[model samples]
Target: MIKNLVHHKDNIVTISETMNCLDAIEILEQHSLRNAPVVDATNTLYRGNIYRYHIYKYKFHHPDADLAQVKVTQFLKNTTRVVHENDSFYQLIFAIRDLPFIAVLDKENVFTGVIQHDVMINYLAQAWVADKSGYVLAIQTRGEKGELNKLARLVNRKADIQSAVTFEKTTYDTSTYLMVTLPEYLDVSSVRALVNDLTRRKYDVNVVTL
Candidate 1:
């Protein structure tokens, strides 16, 4: 399913290993990129990433260094962060947390494509059906069993449940936030009724219009 997040090979911007820092900086600036993946001489093997700031910082620290002599490989990084096509979404999430994107390679280490954070945001937006009109009920619970079923039962009686996503557990109180969405056909009264029901059941609930 994570393949849906991948930007295919032809869509990736790459800098050749032989390319100088001066040229790489220009290309990165033109694309409004902070960094770009680097490839081997044949442009098949993925070397790593080259950052625009790193090139400028290097020049500032070493003013005498010739820009033409500075190859992109000199500042290559995140070589080990690349993922295989079959890698999982959870793995990609951790691998790309600190990176703008993660380069994806084939079994032979051939550069295939990349998965960027922006694409991940889009995927999450699609999952939330953000473009469609709906109301989100942000509910907090203590992870008690039967709570979700009760909430679902109550919501379904009044409105169609568009989607439900559980956010990460809160460290402070060890509670979970469940975002339940209602279809556009429902009104504020429907949401208010559900909120009152959940509140009476000791479930912390709030409604947000989307």
Candidate 2:
């Protein structure tokens, strides 16, 4: 999964402690970044993050103020930021949607970097495309292994299917389930044939779309 590739990469923008509000705004415009992390001299920990909207609004309201005199810290967003590394693409999508950009924090809450919404979305889309395999939810069975293999083989014979798998075991009975994805759509008769074949073999099969 793309979650494994998520890490504190150096691609993230950073602002120095000495940077003024104008400097931070200029940097944000230059890099096309909405938010950036503020770091001290050693660049060990992040003090806060500055959003472009804050700077723009301040400039609009206080047009006559000296830009150099305004401190970047004064305009920083003081709220706690959500961050995650190695989180699944599914989780990352919701996180990015909920938060502006998740600050990639280390064990000590030290800022490592940030994951932008666009970047994370692209990663998730790619992962979805890669995981083209089909999934099935089945009831547990006594001889599930052999039955699943045979069912998979039957499906593959009619279509260009790949990577069949099962999910979400229910404990009501010994029934097994499998999920398969085909390169193309299967006709209703083909699906019915599969159900009939499983029934004849004394295996209770339920096919579901995922």
Q: What local distance difference test score does each model get? A: 0.84, 0.65
Q: Give per-residue CA lDDT, model 1, range 48-132, as digits (tens).
A: 8999889999999999988887788889999888888888877878888978898988778888889998998788787777777
Which candidate ranks first by lDDT, i.e. highest?
1
CA error at residue 204 for candidate 2, angstroms: 21
TM-score for each candidate, following the candidate numbering:
0.90, 0.58
lDDT per residue, candidate 2, 1-210, as tens digits? 433444463666788777898888889999998878787777766677788898888888989987788888887664365554555666666656755566665666666677766677666445444345343324335554476666667666666654445654468653345555544255657766766776787766666554
lDDT of 1: 0.84
Alpha-carbon runs more than 4 Å astray in model 1: 172-174
Residue 21, model 1: Cα distance from true site in angstroms: 1.3
Relative to the true structure, candidate 2 reaches a TM of 0.58
RMSD of each: 2.0, 7.2
